[model samples]
Target: MNTAEVLVESLEREGVECVFGIPGEETEALLFALRDSEVTFVPTRHEQGAAFMADVHGRLTGTAGVCLSTLGPGATNLLTGVADANLDKAPLVAITGQGGLERLHKESHQALDVVDMFEPVTKWNAQISDPDIVHESVRKAFKVAEYEKPGATHVELPEDVASEECDVRPLDRRERVRRPDPDEPSIDAVRELLADADRPICIAGNGAVRTDASAALRALASDYDLPVAATYMGKGAVSDADDHSLLTLDSGDHEEASDAIQSADLVVTVGYDIAEHDPADWNPSGETTIVHLDSDPAEVYEHYNPDVEVVADIAAAVRELNACCADLDAEFETDWYDDVRDHIVADVTPEINAGDPFTHRGVVTVLRDAMADDDVLVSDVGTHKMVIAQNFRTFEPNTCIVSNGLASMGISVPGGLAADLAVDSNVVAATGDGGFMMNAAEIETATRLDCGYTILLFRDDEYRLIADEQTDHRGEHFGTEFSNPDFQTFAESFGIEAYRPDGWDELRDDLEAAVESDEMAVVEVVLG
Candidate 1:
């Protein structure tokens, strides 16, 4: 079989249903190979959209989402999304077509050191110069990308090597890799720590949202009477509908959430990644004893020194802790956290008023109510992301997708496309003016693919997130404002139905209709 054919076979072995990217001259052989396989190749408007699609796909499926690109500019455009996946801990494999090896050493058209450029952002990356290793390389790519603490991995295939004839067969799919479980001593230490603390609080991170992990955590919280506060990326790690939920744990102008953390005697961080919330913000005094549980070891920092660490499969670790809960009838007083929970509930709870302006928090509240428990809402990076994290209530894990690692601005639109492709439930892409305009061209791609999802576009004609930051620091902001076209016309031009909802009544009605429909739609809300 040809090298490209072997690569496609390897991809098939990984159970890759779709590969996203634009077809280019260098990827001609690879494209033809995909054409002959069962894998559907989605061509997006831009390389960044392809990577974002793969990023969300991986986030939903726990498999490595695959994206392809040609050399140079295409690969560069693909960088932001790849970096997003890497930091967000979503498994993704990005494949790039390189120019012929013979001309790669010397500067040539579209021949840049893509492998080198991708090294900093990827977990692992390599270029395959030998046609014989195509199967091995592809297999390695998937393995590394899907490993624990998963992130992006890269595979570079030169055009000449892709076109070469080869006899090597694609590698047989190996058994699923199992993450290591924590030892008895580690579990014992965690049990002891939990038993001693009277006002212990648990912080859930993105890693804690796996179906099994969430189940275990809920049981642990219920049995031990622990309040779970989710990091922004960790929203829905514990359902907001649950009584033990603290809604969201963040540091900012919100005194209630911060006060809750400050009063916490012991912080049990499960699947926590410091990237989502800095340790210093929560542990400014450096006095609270911390318990770390995750797939990876605790990241070393001045503010984050764990008294006990149980590093293993996060679900398994929590399950072990739950089993230990039987040893002690740990009944920490829950009354202290009640006001914190009440404040959060009242904060996100929307009040419809005729005189009120369209607020970001209100949009999130209405949208959350409109969505089903299993539905997915992808939040693009912006001020609205902060609002959603603080106010949006998600009942299930991965239901609310936020790009916090790289926290790229233009992810929501393309992310919605991936979320739709990954799940049977309804998908929504929440974006503000700046973020919407960045990847708005993907409306055409979604329409072309016949993907059904809603684009919840909020327009304020400015980069209000940055503007808000400037207002905090310098007391004024500049160059953070921008303009926009009528998003209704923009979506309609792409052959999709669009709605500009006037008020709360229209917005709630529009949201229900858009989500229930089987065709792509847009609901544009002006946040003036």
Candidate 2:
């Protein structure tokens, strides 16, 4: 068997169902091998779109989503989405074809040092210089990428090495990697702390939801009368409909949830990562006692010194905490949490007087009503992102994906494609005009794949998020406005059905029709 065959075999053994990328000369051998294997290769319109597809796939599935690209420009194009996956804590394996081993000593065309460029953005990375090491490298890439605090990992295979005749076999993934259990002392300390504290609250982060700690989180909250506030990426860590839920706390200053966190005597952060939401934003005083539970220790931040850390598998840690705090006789007060949650609900409540113009909130409200509990919504980075985060309440974990870590735009379309492919759930790629244009070409890719999903494009004809920021700070804005192509025409040009909803009423019907159609469709809603 050749090295490329062995590499593909390794990916299959790793349970990679599909690989996304653009075809190139350097990846010729690998492409042919993948074509012959059970692992399907999804050719995307652009390398960035391919990476975003893999990113969303990773977020949906606990396994690493794989993306491939050739050297230099191709590799560079994949950087943004790969970095987004890394910061968003999505498990992803990024494979890139590099120049031949013989040309390493000299500067070659389309051969920038791909490994060096990927170092900062990846959890681990390596170039398989030797053909024999391909299996080992591939195995390590998947393992590292899917490990706790899951992020992106890279593997580079040179063209010459890939085509080489190597007698090698893929590694066997016989056992699961289990996280260490939380120390008994730490759990004991957390129990004692929870018992002593009068006003305690839980801040659930992305890790909590992604690690399947939501059930345990709900139990902990339900049992202790603890209020659970999710970070943006951690939406639905606890059901927003639950009385214990405090939807989001990312809007720090002047937000009721922020005030709730400040007023709490003890703040229990479950699987919270400092990257998505800064402790300084919510805990300005730095005096609130923190108890963190996760697979890793809390980050050493000025405002995030944890008094007790239950470092273990998030679900296991939370379950242990629940079991530990099961018999607490302490009486805690949740009147403040009730007030904050009520305010949050009121703030996000739609201001729609029937038949009004479709604003961001209106579109989100209608879409939410149309989707099932487990259906997915991939939110692009824009002003609509703020609207969705504030107003849209996900009933289940990982149902609402927002790239808040790297927070890259242009992810929605491609991400929705992956979401559709990875799960048996209806998907909606919600994007503003600005973000939709960035990867609009991928609509064709989605069409080719027959990905039956809805594209909810909010048209404002500018970089609305940035414009809003400018408007808030200053009276005027510059370089934030732009013109949009006829969105319906653009979407239809890709051979997909497009709907330019006339008003709020039409939008609701259009969204339901698009999703129910089970065909590639775009529903354009004009936003102010």
Q: Per-candidate TM vs. native?
A: 0.98, 0.98
CA error at residue 399 for candidate 2, angstroms: 0.2
Tell me how candidate 2 scores on lDDT: 0.88
Q: Taking the tens digit of each residue's C-alpha lDDT, what string does model 2 give over 142-253?
A: 8888888899999998999999999879999755577888888998898888778889888999989888999889988888788988889889999989999888884322
lDDT score at residue 245, model 1, on the 0-100 scale: 89
Give candidate 1 misplaced runs (Cα > 4 Å): 251-253
Q: Alpha carbon lDDT of residue 450, candidate 1?
A: 88
lDDT of 2 at 263: 86
